[model samples]
Target: MRLLALDRFTWRRIYWILLVFLVILITVWWQPNRTFPTGGSLARDSANPQQVKGAIQPIPLSVDLDVEKVALGEELFRDKRLSADNQVSCLSCHHFKRGGADRQTYSVGSGGVPGDINALTVFNAGFNFRFNWNGAYETLEDQIQATLQNPKAMGSQWNEVVEELQATPEYPKLFARAYADGLTAENIKDAIATYIKSLYTPNSRFDQYLKGDEQALTPDEKAGYQLFQDYGCISCHQGMNIGGNMFQRFGVIGDYFDPKDGITQADLGYYNVTKDEADRYVFRVPSLRNVALTAPYMHNGSVETLEEMVKIVAKAQLGRTLSEGDTDLIVQFLKTLTGEYLGGSLEKLALDSDDDITS
Candidate 1:
């Protein structure tokens, strides 16, 4: 009996020792292999293909979509008849030449009324987990419907919009080609959203660097990218879209709004939607893709220059004061994010006038 007891104790001790060893092994393995939220697996270094690093992934060059739907949707996107006054269209605010956003602090709405918030870029918007600054809509279709009905936007009833489109000589034919349903409100919204999804701008220099092109980025820009990761900017902005994957408070470290300026309803952010006090000033993190072309910055468009915006965001969000030299380097890295759209660089397209754009 004594010998049997001794054997039992010895076996139990060995089992516990193995269990502890397994736990340690797992901890060590997971620590290195674990991925950040929305970040891709570590990529190989451009210079040394064997060395793995980086979290950001390249945007896909193209997405498969129905060509007929895309063509019909593009027409609707530019059509003024969708608005109540027949003066505003989606393109009025989302300009292809201007990085898919109008370069205005507040977009001029249908009757010359300014909007409550800055217009986010339409390019790469489909990559976002949710739509709008407050995340009020879950799907692109929902956002489109709301925008159409919103008094400050298109301001048109769905019935009227459908009727007008059905009456238009070209729209019926376009709708028939895109959908068998032909000119329903649902089909119209779907077509428009489909086209918006096709607006992704890919093949940026940064994407080339990610895909193992050593010469894509300058030495300073590469250093800036390293600094971006080291400084924890990647925590919220480390996805294919570089942002738009998460919601974060505008000011994580300190108060960003001025008391004297007075808070508007728009400043309430998700709080207006949820009516929860905790949600105040919380917003969907805007994508940094093509950010250099779409300025002024922030939800309110308070910061005019990209450099000034970077300084403000660093101080408010990261609680760090960046040196002038560091700021310049980071800005240079950001500029490399501007990508190709419609077989042309967005920077080159921005120089084209509205007339040229329509032509």
Candidate 2:
């Protein structure tokens, strides 16, 4: 009887091990695009790739730029006088070396006040028809003025900023050279706006591939692009900037925010601008150029790695939870979007690997 009992117990243990192995095998087999694109180009393999073609357009390598205006804007963007305490400038939040973003969910501004929302990249500001996450300002100059006046940002009115610049002898001559109107508040906005517009980045590997350079991207990257399109990421994130073209509701398939998690007024999104119920949670889509270089993704900057961000976006926007291997494959494609900085090269920016995104 003892011998019979031992044999039964051993068989039970073997049965359990086989069950576990089968589960893993079935899981892998069930999920399509587990490690790469299922087959061919997205257009050929996908049921409707032509419909997606208009959703995303490639960026050009370069654009006609005004060198003088961009130079002045670059200087003013770094000069701390734009802030009330002379302690903050645009560069404080948007670092050139850091994909034109501070990588902070909430950036500190004038008077050491933390900004309410995440700072968006200024790298491709010119491509967007509207500015700011809420599309609050229609033009970059308007956005500049809002920043200069917002207490949490520059924290000063135009008169004080203009007066300070007028007293500075060097600024007067620089302004005169850039604009016929010279160093007035309007001209300041114009020159700075011109410069900000010139901050466009291009010549990424993906762009080269779009320009008919077949070898610009690797096999994995190409698969990722195919998955990117197949998964409907191209729906909102299209156009020259790969996003920043229109507004979309934050949680299309699922509610992403909870007031219990310390939600603030900024979370209300375009509702704050229009005061309409339908406008709630509507925000301008951010550009994906240099996305690999810019970490801590999302408007809140809450998501950590690119893989995790893709999963969250898939769930919230498309109502799908991707397999781990599929997520990694899509991330491989996004890395190809990192491009050369306009007028210079961009070093791969550091990521905040310590982010706690368990929630």
Provide the overall lDDT of each model, using Cα atoms, as 2-decimal numbers.
0.84, 0.80
TM-score of each: 0.86, 0.82
Q: Taking the tens digit of each residue's C-alpha lDDT, what string does model 1 give over 1-359?
A: 99999999999999999999999999897674343322222122223323225557899988999999999899999998999889999998899888899888988777776688999899999888899988888999999999999878888899999999888889998888778878899999999999999999999999999999989999999988876665556667757888887777777777887678899888888898899987899888788889999998988888898889888887777787999988888888888999988778998898776666541
Give me the overall lDDT of model 2. Answer: 0.80
The number of clashing residue pairs in each candidate reads: 0, 0
Error of 1 at 168 (Å): 1.1
